[model samples]
Target: MNGPGCAAGFRHHTRYARSMSGNRKRILIVGGGYVGLVTALRLQKLLRRQLKRGEVEIVVVDPRSFMTYQPFLPEASAGSLEPRHVVVPLRRVLDKCDVRTARVTRIDHARRIATLAPHVGDPYDLRYDELVVGVGAVPRTLPIPGLAEFGIGFKTIEEAIGLRNRVLDKLDEADALPYSDPRFRELRARLLTFVFVGGGFAGVEALAELEDMARDACRLYNEVKREDMRWVLVEAAGKIIPEFGEELSDYTRQRLEERGIEVKLNTRLESCVNGHIVLSDGTEFDADTLVWTAGVKPNPMLRDTDLPLGPKGHVVCLPTLQVKDTPHAWAAGDCAQVPDLAKGPGAYCPPTAQHGVRQAKHLARNIQRVMQGKPPTPFKHKNKGAVAGLGLHKGVANLLGWIHLKGWPAWFVHRTYHLYAVPTLNRKVRTVVDWTLALFFRREIVSLGTLHSPREEFAEVAAESAPQPEAASRTPGQPVPKAGAPKAG
Candidate 1:
């Protein structure tokens, strides 16, 4: 807790004395992601009286103020859903709790203090009686050549929308060039080619959705044809969406091939230097877009805490979702290695939205059980299968291990399930509205890349208007020269 400005005074306050005097217990949640938001919501209902009587306090902290519904990311990127509708603003929903838009730099469980680094102000320590660690996992990346320089990740809302604009902009670039020239053809091919690494749900869904959108957009362009674009999916594994089993995996691959997508199995990307991709199969191609969605690793921030972690760096949690050997500390979601009692011994819950949602509710109940001096129940839930959207009116689903759905039926199920799963009623209505309007109208293919750098044009104008040193030093009789005009000797 020792720091420059406020740490000395903050350390002076004893944790026990503060709780003793106020008769209030503070619950600090380290993240505002899936588990964090849901846990806080459940706690509000379970401990409503204590919260109203000022007997309990809940604090949620995260860098971003909104919780993104990740399942709808592909649709958002493909313009099927509005970008704003996919992200729920935390402040609006968790109105009862104190939401802090900051990052927890470190956690000291032995002292019950968490160091928070705000966006603007100084870093400070926060004291809490109970702690919930749900910081979530980050995209697992490899140290590949040129990967960091020219790789797009499909995780957050910003990246999703940005990728959408970039794809459309590439189409625009290709359309502007003359088709008769051979040099322009090569350049156009590069611009139109899209490469996605990893055969997981994220890579498949993103590649499929964007390719469909780009194909539809080609109808309006005179030069860019659907055949001119190349959509390639590179996976090191022999199968895609392996969790869905071999039957669905083969079906998915065959379906993607029918749509003119190249699915390379047991392939690895050796390098992508300056947009030129080199694969392990000795294939080389120039591309303008590369998206990496290989896998995810536990949040590296967990190493800064005093809690015990598994070999994979995830916080080890018992069947009750409590951190092992640590009382009053809980964890779940992608960052915690929670024992999957439903799956039996040596098994852990997979990092999926379905499990995270269920774990949050269960973890909230366990917290209440401890408060009531009752033994916490073990967390258990049967696997609900998996569903994925490929493109407009195309999908695949596996329900209850016995039921299999494909094409439009699976697509409908995907949409319906996610609509029911999205956080708030407001977002659900807005998403449905977007889908309803899409039925009567065409998809908007406009590229809004300027959103990234809105001030570029203004900055250029200001630089042009700026007075030069020579102009400033000129005599009073000398004429002031106009910008970009000839200079007098």
Candidate 2:
């Protein structure tokens, strides 16, 4: 490991020596996503002795302080789960490690330093002996017109809750207007229309869950009817959820269509300027809500580092999960192109929660081996199948290759897998409580959009109570008149 770059990094400055004083080595993990969080948890247990004796240090850096469990986001958006229970706070879980709420601006592996920028403080440099890159992917957006200004993404917990508010608020606004009014004909239709541009799990599941919730909500409104709403799903590929196998993909499409959703396959979105959509199939319409979940790309921050990257802007990793030809640097998850040893020479593992959790454990064990002057082992995990939920009691799952289930059976499996996967026993209990309570009562349909602008009312009151300027009739040296006291004519 003592190559030219590695040696220079050690000798670049005295800060490195200061950080390593008393033989304590710092392991810097650059992300707080699923992989980073899991790796830190495993390492804290595996290196318990070193951490206790001040011989090792682990630091996790991310802009946000919590790690979101993304699989349950659909349920949260549909009001089946509370938004607060969908994220795991890093500080509460990693008691033995240092958790820094900051973003990594740049990485200089040649000097073993990383630049960090917090939300409020100035940027500073952090030195580390071992590095892990797990900064995950961002939404893959197209150059289509109006997408940046109009489309919403379904990535974070905040976004999921915000989408819920937006949908319910739209229904409320449309219900208050008169449907027979000619002037509101087009506006009412726009308010009732919802468009989703993606057929992947995130897009399909979100649409299904939200649609079901909205349909149930219609019963509470006297003016709103379920038949008046329009739901359209547009996919560029010939099929939706290609990873679910051809048979299951067809089944999912049929289920969605049975619920009055228009599935447009082999079609593309041309434009959506000013809420007017024009598709590649010449279907033009007006909609108030548009969601983009097409795909995701690797974090762009990798370009600013000294690591060797793959052609698709991902860090290249060998089967052992080490950055190709770069010592003391490792990467996994969506940001790294880890060779799939289970699939043979030319294949790579798909970016999913199943692969990520297993890789994190393997990487943690490998790091301990390297620290003890032992060789690292390769990471290998076979693909387990995929499961997805559609609305309330409908779903589909393909386990291994021979086991196929649909409807209630698949939905139950979907819930069972994610519930078992969510970190921390505290969170698992809270989530289960939410689900249990939901069985006796209907899902909440109230929209809390005011949470976004809670200070607006206070600001308005403050503006009205502000002191008024002195009257023009008063002398220059005289005392100024109080607000609302009296005004000279």
lDDT of 1: 0.93
lDDT, residue 381, model 1:
91
lDDT over C-alpha atoms for residue 53 of model 1: 91
Give the residue spans of candidate 2 off by over 4 A.
Answer: 1-22, 470-489
> Per-residue CA lDDT of candidate 2, range 1-489, in tens?
346654455454346446565568999999998889999999999999999999999999999999999989999999999999999999999999999898999999999999987665456688889999999899999999999999999999989999999999999999999877888988889999999999999999999999999999999997788898999999999999898899999999999999899999999999999889999999999999999989999999999999999899999998889999999999999998999988898999998988888888899999999999999999999888999989898899999966889999999999998999998898999999999998999998999999999999999999887755544456778776577877555
TM-scores of the models, in the given order?
Answer: 0.94, 0.93
lDDT per residue for candidate 1 within 1-489, as digits (tens), equals 335544544444335336544568899999999999999999999999989998888999999999999999999999999999999999999999999898999999999999988776567778889999999999999988999999999999999999999999999999999888888988999999999999999999999999989989999999899998999999999999998899999999999999999999999999998999999999999999999999999999999999999999999999999999998999999999998888989999999999998999999999999988999998999998999999999999999998999999999999999999999899999999999999999989889999999999999999999988998889989988888999887
For each candidate in the order shown, give its overall lDDT on alpha carbons.
0.93, 0.91
**Stretch of 10 with least lDDT, candidate 2:** 5-14
